[model samples]
Target: MIENQIGKRFAEALSDSITDDDRVEEARDNLRQFCNAMEQDSQLGRFFLHPSIPEENKAALVMEFCEKISALEEVRNLMRMLVERQKMCFVKNVSAYFDEVVARRLNQARVQVVSAQPLSEDHIKKLKTMLDRVLGKSALLETRVDESLLGGLKLSVGSLVADASIKNALALLKQSIEKEEVLSEFASG
Candidate 1:
């Protein structure tokens, strides 16, 4: 919860810094790229979070990288703030929060859909429509095929999850059967 609050603070501060809509979009991309890079590269993530590395050095490294990428000053400031506060490990969370804030500002919902097989455009559209009705916002769906789902699909919107997969259904059925067997054994005893 504290980590979430820290991330939200940074995301809100960054959001407040942007004056133009285009800059907000650009900062979103910049932050996503920066956070993904840190997450994908353990060494890079460590360099920022490592205890031995001075905070100033970490800030300098981030500033240089941001300058090279021509990132918005707001993004650079956010990176520096995270480094100084020893919260570099929360970069991904910050990005997620920032994206949520931007999406809220735009009245759009970003959702992820996982299914046993790739869905057709029409199917995705229908799913989006369902999500729109549920979330009361325009839904933007990101689809992925996960064979492990066995059948059907799962939808994740922010913190909410809607699981309709056969695997989940079977698991629930098994739990119910187990409970019934236990109850019968207790009665017999």
Candidate 2:
């Protein structure tokens, strides 16, 4: 929704203003946290986003929050840019899409790993290193233990899947048999 509405435009504009890739993350994170808070709480959201609210007030509050983080100058600049452009309404989507762009630049991937058992720090570190090497980029991994997988792990990154779990193997076997049965019936007919 908001992603579709503002993602591309926000990404292009944000990328242009901010050159350092990490600053993109900082801007994105700050915008996201601020937007999320405002969205979840109606009174503040209305107060800040109301058309009647003066730009000075918005800029002051933005500076106050930005100061709390001890963040880079680029972050404050980005927030100031949003305030100046009157685009703070879309800050949430802007941050989400900006992070997506930043991730793309780093060639970073969000890998979801579901294993039959919880992974130890050693396992995660080893896996992270392996993914970075194999993928030729950084990896932001979210690992979870899904006992329903029966055994082994199932990894998914974007559209790619590396399913080594017992449950998936069994499902694959079942599908193969059903396909074979259908083929046999067609041949007989």
Candidate 3:
């Protein structure tokens, strides 16, 4: 919970620093790229997380990385601040929340749709249209196939999940049956 707050604070700070929507997007991309590098390169990750490493070295490395990625000055400052505060571990969290903040700022909703099979373009378009109407804002739909769903789709918008999958339906049915059986036993007793 504290980590989430920390991540949100940093994300908001970065988001507030940039005035242009395009610059905000660029900063987000730069942050994602930096986080990806940290995740993909174990040595680099170690360098950031290592306690004994000098702060000067870490700051220098961050600056060098920002230059390589053509990061915005705001983004560079964010990284430097994180390094100084020893919050390198929260980079991924910050990136994730940064996306959320940006989406909110742009009056967009990021919806994740998981289905048993790949959805056709027409289907996606229809779904997006429906979601846009329901959300009252443009929906940024991200679709993925998860065969375990059996059928139907699961829609995730931020913390809310609407599970219409066959697997979930089966689980709900089973729970209902169990509850009915328990109620029947009590009545008989």
Candidate 4:
């Protein structure tokens, strides 16, 4: 809970900084990249998030890395703020929320489409077009093929999920039969 509270605070501050149209997108990308690098290099994540270290030294090291990756001033300032406050673990959460905030500002959405089989370029392009129209904003579609999905497709566009998989169909059928049985019992009562 404490971590979530701290993450929310950082996310809110970052969101506020994104009001300047010129800075939001690039800032979000840089932040995500920084967070990705941190995730990929666990040692770096541990070094920055370690509470045992002197805050100034940690902040300096993070600032140096932040400067090396991105020219976006907004991102640099955000990195400095996180490092100085020793809130570096929340960087990943902040990056995710930052993207959500920016997408909301643009009236756009980031979507993930997963399928058991690979999709052609035409399939992906058509899906993007349909989603953009349905969503009323441009869509950034991330495509993945997970064999566990077991054919059909699963689309997660913002908070809504469209499941067209056989697994979900079977689950729905099972749910419907259960509901029907319950209703029959109530009727007999």
Model 3 lDDT tens row, 38-106: 888989989999999999999999999999999999999999999999998899899999999999898
Model 1 lDDT per residue over 109-157, tens place: 8899999999998998888888899889989898999998899999998
Q: Best by lDDT, which number?
A: 3
What residue runs in model 1 are displaced by over 4 Å at the alpha carbon? 54-56, 84-86, 171-189
Of candidate 1, the 10-residue stretch with the lowest lDDT total is 33-42
RMSD in angstroms, all models?
A: 3.1, 3.5, 2.3, 3.2
User: What's the lDDT for all of these models?
Assistant: 0.88, 0.80, 0.95, 0.82
Question: lDDT per residue, candidate 4, 1-189, as tens digits?
Answer: 777667667767876866676677778778878877887989998887677889888878877877787647677887888877667878887877777778888788899999989999999999999989988898999999888877899999767999998778888999999999999999999
TM-score of model number 3: 0.85
Residue clash pairs of candidate 1: none
Query: Can you rank all candidates by lDDT, best first?
Result: 3, 1, 4, 2
Q: TM-score for each prediction?
A: 0.77, 0.73, 0.85, 0.82
lDDT of 1: 0.88
The number of residue pairs in model 1 that clash at the backbone is 0
Which ten-residue region of model 3 has the weakest summed lDDT? 35-44
Model 3 misplaced regions, further than 4 Å: 176-189
Q: How many residue pairs clash in each candidate?
A: 0, 0, 0, 0
lDDT of 2 by residue, 23-84 (tens): 76776677667777677887866666678889899889888878886656766777787787
- Give candidate 1's TM-score: 0.77
Which scores better on lDDT, 1 or 4? 1
